[model samples]
Target: SMFVTNSSFCTESKECLEYLLVCKTDEYEVRHYSPTRWVSTDAEAYFMGVGAAMAFRRLFQYINGANEGGFQMEMTAPVLVKIPEETRMWEPAVYSLGFPLPAAYQEKPPAPTSNKLYFSEMPEMDVYVRSYGGWMLSVTSRLHAHLLTEELGRVGASYNHSYHYGVGYDSPLKLLNRHNEVWYVSEGEGSFTSQRLV
Candidate 1:
C-alpha cells in the first residue's frame, strides 16, 4: 500500500491555526490536528503553533517512511493567506481560533474522546492554495480570509455559502523542535495538487 501527506501554514497572526493531514492507501487511514491550539496568545504563540504542527507531520512521515507496500502516496503542504474585508469577492466561510497546549502545561497527551480533533467529513469541492515561510507579525485570521477572497476574485472563483474550517498541525514538544511546519485546510477540492517536501 501507499500513503500521502501534506502541510500548510498561515502567514498572518489571525490565521494562527496550522494543520497536517495524512492518508494511507492500504489501511485507508487519515489523521489531522493542530498542535499549538492550546497556548494563549503572547509573543510567539502563532509561530510556536505553526512550528509544532510542522514538526509532528514530519515525525509522522519519518516513522512511516520505511514501510514497504504496493500502494503509493503523495503529500501536499499549503499555507492559507488572510483575505481583506474590502474585497467583495468570495463569500466568507466558517472561522475559528485556538491556542496550542504546551508540553509543560500538560503531563501527557490528551485522550481522544471525540472525532472533532481527528477528522470531519467535508463536502467535495475544488480550491486554490498558497504557502509561506518565515515569521509573520501583526497578522490576523481576517487577513487570511481577505487574501483568499482576493485570490478567488482574481481567478473569477466565487466563494460558496458554507463553513470553512482551519487545521493547525503541531508537536507536543517545544517550539525549538526542527522540521516543524503548520498547514491549514481552507477549502475542499474537486482535484488535488501534490508535492514532495525537501
Candidate 2:
C-alpha cells in the first residue's frame, strides 16, 4: 500500500470530487507557499509536442540539481499546465507546466542551472476546479477548461481571471485511473482579475 496524506485541503463541489480519481500518485504536497501570494496574471499556453517535453526537461534538470552542488531534489505532485485559447491539430497553443515541491525544501532550493527553471512558493487559494481522467492533451485541456468556465457561469459563481492552471497527477505509464484537474482561481476581495481562468 502507498503512503497516503491528508485529503481535501481546499473545498470541492460534489461534481469536482465525484469525478473518478486515483490518489497518492504524486509527491508530498506542500500547502504553505510564501512570497508568491497568488497565481500571476498571464496567458501562457505552451505548444503541444516539444513544448511540453522541453518544459519538463528543463525542470527535471533543475530538480536533479544541475546547479552548483549537484544536490538532487525530490519531485512533487500535480504537474500543472496552463493552456491557451487558440490551438490547432496536434499543434496546441502556447502553455506553461509546473511541478510542486515539499515545503521543507523551499527555503533553500538548489540554484537552477537554467534561467527558465526557478523556485516558487505558491500561496493558498480558492479556485474553481474541474476534474477529469485520462492523459492531459491539448484538446482535453481546452474541453475541460470550457466545461469548467461554463459551469461557473451557470452557477453564478464569481471568479477572477488570474491564470488557469492544469493539475496533472500520475505518470504516463500508469494508464488506468489517471487524475487531472484544471483550476480557475476565485476573484479576490479586491479588483484583481484572474488571467488563469478567463
TM per prediction: 0.31, 0.68
Q: Name the 10 consecutive residues with the lowest summed lDDT in model 2.
A: 10-19
Per-residue lDDT over 93-132 for candidate 1, one digit per residue giving the tens place of the 0 to 100 score: 2222323322232233232232222211222333333322
- CA lDDT, candidate 1, residue 44: 17
Best by TM-score: 2
Q: Assess the local accuracy of residue 116 in candidate 1 as a C-alpha lDDT between 0 and 100.
A: 22
| lDDT agreement of model 2 with the native | 0.53
- TM-score, cand. 2 vs. native: 0.68
Residues 88-132 of candidate 2: C-alpha lDDT, one tens digit per residue: 555446656666544444455555566665554444445566778
